[model samples]
Target: MTEPIKIDVWSDIACPWCFIGKRKFEGGVAAFQADADAPEVIVEYHSYELSPDTPVDFEGSEIDFLAEHKGMPAEQLRGMLEQVTGVAAAVGLEYNFDILKHTNTVKAHQLLHYAKAQGIQLQAAERLFSAYFTEGRHLGRAEDLADLGAELGLDRADVLRSLNEDEYLPAVRADQAQAQQFGINGVPFFVIDGKYGVSGAQDPDTFAQVLQQVRSERAEEIPA
Candidate 1:
């Protein structure tokens, strides 16, 4: 039997497009299955922090971070975020940008690493993204993150201990290094089967097409 098609997606919780892209990717997966006879695709979420150095107790608006990081004027930043908010609403996600708490996701990434050890990494990733993007929850605190982990069947005490002790920092750093080595400079980067690189939050059709192509390529290499 052929192995499942593997998709590695690098994304940040704070990235609005990543949430939108995830919905579209799921749509693609559904479409690909309808068009191909390949085994199911297995998606693995990799950690990427947009604001790696943001303070845990950040104050003021999220616009501040965007203006400083992207070198945009404050008014322009609001305009862009407004555009993205419209796009987000179109995808069935309510995005109240004002409630976004910009904070360091390094520790959140650390919890994701710990979840991987327990074989529920994807669950943890989805939860973290939802907490940050959909619900506007603060992901910087260890207690809140531990609660998220617990919701995903992880041991709450252990997760809390890990967060408090700053465990999994090395793993998060390693993930960042891997992203750099792969030439990824932004969120929502996808690599399929270790050969095809899909940059940015592509459309559902694009993801479907890529999945179909990968399925065909793998089928060609397998013996009948």
Candidate 2:
């Protein structure tokens, strides 16, 4: 029996490009699945905060956050955001920057660890991205995270207890520490099979090609 290819993804709920990259990676997985020689794939998401210093409840728009935190001018930031919004739209993600709520994602990341233990990490991730980017829901608070977990059929009380007690905070920090060990300084970083690192929001074809190469190499390692 062959081992499944492991893909570790590091991303934050507040990251727009991470959501877009997720869609692209899904597309690549689907394309790989089309091949007769494709290997089984296992994907696991890790934690990486794009703005760890962001306040729990940021009092500003997306542009305002960038302008204040990143020192980017409003006019230039607007244009940059518009361009990224268009890119997100290309992959079927409607990025509502107008209603986007910028906040610290520590609780959200903790909730993800809870969801991962329940075997619904992907669902939880998609829910978080939608909540933050499209629905404009707040993800910084324990109650909001518990509510989001409930939406994915996770136990709300348990979610709240976990968040309140900081149950998964260690896991979240571990993921971040590992990211640093890998010298990863950005969100949406893809680590394939514990060796290859693909950074940023790359094209679907790029991921598909890399998967194919990994699969081929694995096949060659087996005894005839």
Candidate 3:
């Protein structure tokens, strides 16, 4: 049997487009699975902090955070957020920008590494995104992350201990370092089969096409 294609994705839980891209990629996977020759895919999410310098408990609205960070006017930032919010909605994601809790995502990224060790990284990623974009849950603190992990059926105390001890910080940093080595300066970057790199929130068809193309090329390289 052929090995499944591996896809490494670098994204941040705080990134709105990453959630949208996740949905689109799922759609693509579903489409690819419908084909008889489609190979299995293994997706691994990497850490990429959109705003590493953001405070753990930012004392302003999402708009204020963006305005201050990007040096854009409040009104202009509002328009940009609205535009991205609409794009998120188009992909069936109910982005609650009104109550979105903007904060540092380092703890959340660390939790992801822990989840990966437990073989539930994808579920952890989904929960984190939903918490951040739709539910307005604060993901900056270790206690909050432990609660989130508990909700996913992970042991609450263990989660808290690991996070408090910063057990997964090195893994998170390694992912970021790898991202830099790959020259990836953006969120939602996709690397397929360690060769092809796809940037941004591309459409479902684009992902499906790339998977098919890679599968075909790899098959040709095998000695029959």
Candidate 4:
């Protein structure tokens, strides 16, 4: 039997490549788990805000957020979005820029905390990403977010009240502090086995190779 490895991923829903990274990482896990010699891998998703200052009710489109944040030309933003969308598509993801909704994800991260309590953090994360990216659903609204919790068997009223009371702010902050401690300056950063750090959404082959390496290292007998 292979030893288990921990994988901590720092990502945000507003990040296009984060979702892409999620898929790629999942593919890597699938490949590694199927390999006869591969080690066990446990994945934990952490929060990282890309647009922490994004307006809750911005009038402009999602692209406007990036342009304003970086002071980049609109044409340049368009080209960047197009290139990102192309990369997302290559990984079997559909990034609908036309219907994208940009908003502050702090509350969404709070909800992820609640979901984590229920052992559904990954599901809640995926729901929020799909809601904003593809479904054009507004996640900035508290009721809208609670609806997701209700679907996940969380108490709707509790979710609403938690949002109203600003719950899980500490967890969010702690994750941010951890990110800073690790010198993580980007989303989709992954840490494997609590010791190995992997930045970005590396190729599946890389994950497979890493899993193998970690397993082998675990098997080495030290001098007593």
| Candidate 1 lowest-lDDT run of ten | 31-40
Compared with the true structure, what per-residue lDDT tens digits does model 1 show for residues 1-224?
76788899898887888888887788788878885565778988788888777899788777988887788899999998899888878867777778888888888888888998999987887788778876778899999998898899889999999999988988778778999999999979999988999887788899889888877787698789
TM-score of each: 0.92, 0.98, 0.98, 0.93
Local distance difference test values of all predictions, in order:
0.84, 0.93, 0.94, 0.83
Candidate 2 stretches greater than 4 Å from native: none
Of candidate 3, the 10-residue stretch with the lowest lDDT total is 29-38
Displacement of residue 40 (Cα, Å) in model 1 is 1.4
Query: Highest lDDT among the candidates is held by which one?
Result: 3
Please write out the lDDT profile of model 2 over residues 142-208, one tens digit for every residue. Answer: 9999999998998999999999999999999999999999999987999988888999899999899
Root-mean-square deviation of every model: 1.7, 0.9, 0.9, 1.8
lDDT of 3 by residue, 1-224 (tens): 87899999999999988999999999998898898777899999999998899999999999889888889998998898899989999999898889988999999999999999999999999999999999999999999999999999999999999999999999999999999999999989999989999999999999999999998898899999
Candidates, ranked, lDDT: 3, 2, 1, 4
Clashes of 2: 0
For model 4, how does the per-residue alpha-carbon lDDT over 1-224 read when each residue is reduced to its tens digit? 64578889899878787888888888888987786666667777787888788778878886787787788999998998899889888998878887887888888888988888779898888888888777888787789899988987889999999988888878988999999999999988988888777778778888777777777777785444
> Model 2, 85: alpha-carbon shift in Å?
0.8
**Alpha carbon lDDT at 37, candidate 2:** 62
Assess candidate 1 and give its lDDT: 0.84
Model 2: weakest 10-residue lDDT segment is 32-41
